[model samples]
Target: MKLYYMPGACSLSPHIVLRELGLPFELERVDTKSGKTERGADFRALNPKGYVPVLQLDDGRTLTEGPAIVQYLADLAPEARLAPPNGSFERAQLQAWLNYVTSELHKSVGSLFNPSMPAEWRQATQQAIGARFDYLSSRLAGGGFLTGPRFTVADAYLFVVLSWTSHVGLDLARWPALKAFVDRVAARPAVQAALRAEGLA
Candidate 1:
């Protein structure tokens, strides 16, 4: 498998998962602005959506979207238990967390990256994100992963999204539990390997 990624981007989630699963894969750095991969291949040809975190499988099939990619990778190595078994209540809960992180937290935090966004819109977005963070803080205050005591793909996704706080001038310190969550995930060997590989460590 080959994972196309942009350093420190959401792609880092699956990148970390792949490492955690101890799966053999190759990395291709994507220059998002140029729509080109490190090897000079047209990224649009691989994923016309023109984003990072495109996973090319061994048979040459490709997977897009961070949530889907991470879950697919996790299922491939269930013994690692990065995600719950499919069709189970726990799996549904994990899916809920993934959806919340992507649709709510990721989108809100990511919107702040647009330099052309109006000040009013940015303020509103930040306020909206703060509310979401408050809920997450309360849920995580018990001191375990998002779904339970064990870390799952949802935790990997949330960690990547929360890591974006500093880049957007949103301080995680306001949400102590979320801040500690980031610290804990960051200390994981697989996450550390992914970070260094992406030049983010």
Candidate 2:
């Protein structure tokens, strides 16, 4: 499998999952702005949406969307317990968290990265993200990962979004549990390997 990604992008979530499962895969660097892969293939030909985190399977199939890709990889190695069993309540809970992180956290933080975004809109987005952090910090205070003691794909997704805090000028320090969550995820060997491989470490 080859994962097309940009350094420090949301693609890092599945990259971390692949490592957690100890699956053999290669990385293909994508220049998002240029819509080109490292080998200069037109990214739009592979994915019309023109985003990072496109996974090309060994069988010549492709997968996009960070949430779906991570879950697919996790299901491939259920023993790793990166996600709960399909059709179970626990799995549904994991999905809920995944949806929240994708829509509420990821989308909001992503918008702030737009240089053309208005200042007032940026301020509102920041405040909205702050509220999300507040709620997530409280949920995290009770827990060991989003769905239980074992880390799930949801945790990986959240970690990638939280990582953008500093880049967008939002301080994780303002929410200690969320701040600690980032550190805890960072200390994981799989995450460390992903970071190092992506030149983010």
Candidate 3:
């Protein structure tokens, strides 16, 4: 397996998942901005989306999309409890959260990352994202993680998305619970490993 990633992007989610699962895979850094690889090969040859978090299987096939990739990697190591078993209520809840993050939070952040976005669309997205963050802040109150009791894939997505707050000058100070959530997740050994792997720690 080869995980293509950009430093501090959504790619970190799958990277953290792989580390948590103790999966043995190779990491291939992708410079998404340049559309090239560390080896100077055209990255478009691997993923036409020109995005990171593309996991190339040993068989030459590659998986795109962060949510899908992390879930696939989690299913490969169920005993690690990275996610709930299929067909369970927890699994449904997890999927719901994943979908919410992907469609709502993730896409909103991605829209803002685009320098070519329409001014009105960008402003609306910023307001929408702020409301979502406040909702998350309330839900996370007095809890250690997103699900309130255990670590799940949602927390990974949440952490990665919330990490973007700094870039937008969105103050996290009011979202004490969410801020604490970031601190708690960062203190985890697996998350630390993920950070160190990316030279963040």
Candidate 4:
């Protein structure tokens, strides 16, 4: 399998999962801005959305979207317990958290990066995101991970989203639980390896 990624992007979530599962895979860098891979292949041909985190399977089929890719990869190695068993309540809860991070947190943080975003929208998003952070802080207060004692794909996705706080000038220190959660996730060897591989360490 091969993963097309831009350094420090959402792709880092699946990249970390791959390492956690000890899966042997290849990595190809993508220039999302130009819609080209390092080899000069058109990224839009692989993923019409024109983004990073595109995974090509051995059979030549492809997968896009960070949440889907990470879940698929996690299922590949269930013994790793990167996600809960399929169809279980824990699994559903994991999906719930994933959806929250993707829709509620990820999109809001991403919008702040747009220089031309309207002031009203930016302020609203920041306020909304802050509330979400507060919610997560409470959820994490008793946590080992998002779903339970074990780390899951949801944590991986959330970690990537939270990592964007610095880029948007949001100080995580306001929420001690979240600040500690970031420290905890960053301490994982798989995450560290992914960070170093992406030149983000």
Candidate 5:
């Protein structure tokens, strides 16, 4: 498998999962602005969406979207228990967390990245994100991973999104549980390896 990624981007989630699962894969860095990869291949040909986190499988099939990619990788090694069995109630709960992270938290935090966004909108977005964070803080108050004591694909997704806080000038300190969650996930060997590989550590 080959994972096309942009350093420190959402792709990092699957990248971490790959390492956690001990899967063999190659990494190709994509220059999103230039529409090219490190090997000079046109990225649009691989994923027309023009984004990172594109996973090319052994048979040459490709998978896009961070949530889908991570779940696919996790299911490959069920014994790793990175995700619950499909069609199970726990799996549905995991899906809920993934959806919330992507649709609610990811989108809200991402909107702040647009330099042209108006000040009023940015403030409003921050407040909206704060409310979401409040809920997460409460959910995470038990000091366990989202969904339970065991870490899953949802945790990987959440960790990557929360890592974006600093880049957007949003402080995680306001949410103590979320901040600690970041710290705990960051300390994981797989996550650390991913960070170092991406030049983020």
Candidate 6:
């Protein structure tokens, strides 16, 4: 499998997942701005969407989207317990949280990074993200992680978003649980490995 990614992007989620699963996969660095892979091939030809985190499976299938790819990889190692059993209520619950992280928090963070976005739209996006952060803050007030207790894929997504606080100027000091959560996830060996591989550790 060849995973196309840009380090420290949302692609980091799948990078971390693959590392955690101990999967035998090679990394294909994507220069997102150039729309080209490291080998000088046009990324657009590989993925029309022209995005990172496109996992070219060994079976010759490519998977995109952060949540979908993470869930698929987690299922590959169910005993890793990154996800609950596929058919269980717990699994649905995890999926629900995963969807929230993907649609709500993940995409909203994009607006902050794009200066080309309209000011009003960016402000509105920031406000919406702020509300969601508050919601997560309260939910995490009880401690542990996003879904409470063990670290699930939801925590992984949240970690990716929260780490962007430095880039977006989002104040982490306001959310105690969130700040603590970032620290905890950063300390994980797999996460550190991902960071080191990206040269950001």
For every model shown, what is its TM-score relative to the native structure?
0.99, 0.97, 0.92, 0.97, 0.99, 0.95
Question: What is candidate 1's lDDT per residue for 149-176, written digit by digit as tens?
Answer: 9999999999999999999989988899
Tens-place lDDT digits, model 4, residues 1-201: 999998878898899899889999999999988888999998999999998899999999999999999999999999999988899998888899989988998888988889999888889889999999999999999758888788888898889889989998799999989988889999999999999999999
Worst 10 residues of 5 by lDDT: 105-114
Residue runs of model 5 more than 4 Å from their true location after superposition: none
Determine which window of 10 residues in candidate 3 has minimal summed lDDT: 144-153
Q: Total backbone clashes of model 4?
A: 0
**Model 5 Cα lDDT, one tens digit per residue, 1-201:** 999999888999999999999999999999999999999999999999999899999899999999999999999999999999999999999999999999999889988889999999999999999999999999999898999899998999899999999999899988999999999999999999999999999
lDDT for each of the candidates?
0.94, 0.93, 0.86, 0.91, 0.95, 0.87
Q: For candidate 5, what is the total of clashing residue pairs?
A: 0
lDDT of 3: 0.86
For model 1, give the 10-residue run with minimal summed lDDT.
142-151
Q: What would the TM-score be for candidate 4 when compared with the true structure?
A: 0.97
For candidate 6, lDDT tens digit of each residue in 18-98? 888888889889997899899998998888998888988888788998889899999998889899988999989998998
Q: List the residue pairs that clash in candidate 6.
A: none
Candidates 3 and 5, the one with greater TM-score: 5
Worst 10 residues of 6 by lDDT: 140-149
Model 4 C-alpha lDDT versus the unseen true structure: 0.91
The list of candidate 1 runs beyond 4 A from truth reads: none
Q: Give, for candidate 2, the lowest lDDT window spanning 10 residues.
A: 141-150
Quote the positional error of residue 16 for candidate 6 in Å.
Answer: 0.7
Across 1-201, the per-residue lDDT of candidate 2 in tens digits comes to 999999999999999999999999999999989999999999989899999899999998999999999999999999998988999998999999999999999999988899999899999999998889999989888657887678889999999999998998998888988888899899999999999999999
RMSD of 3: 1.7
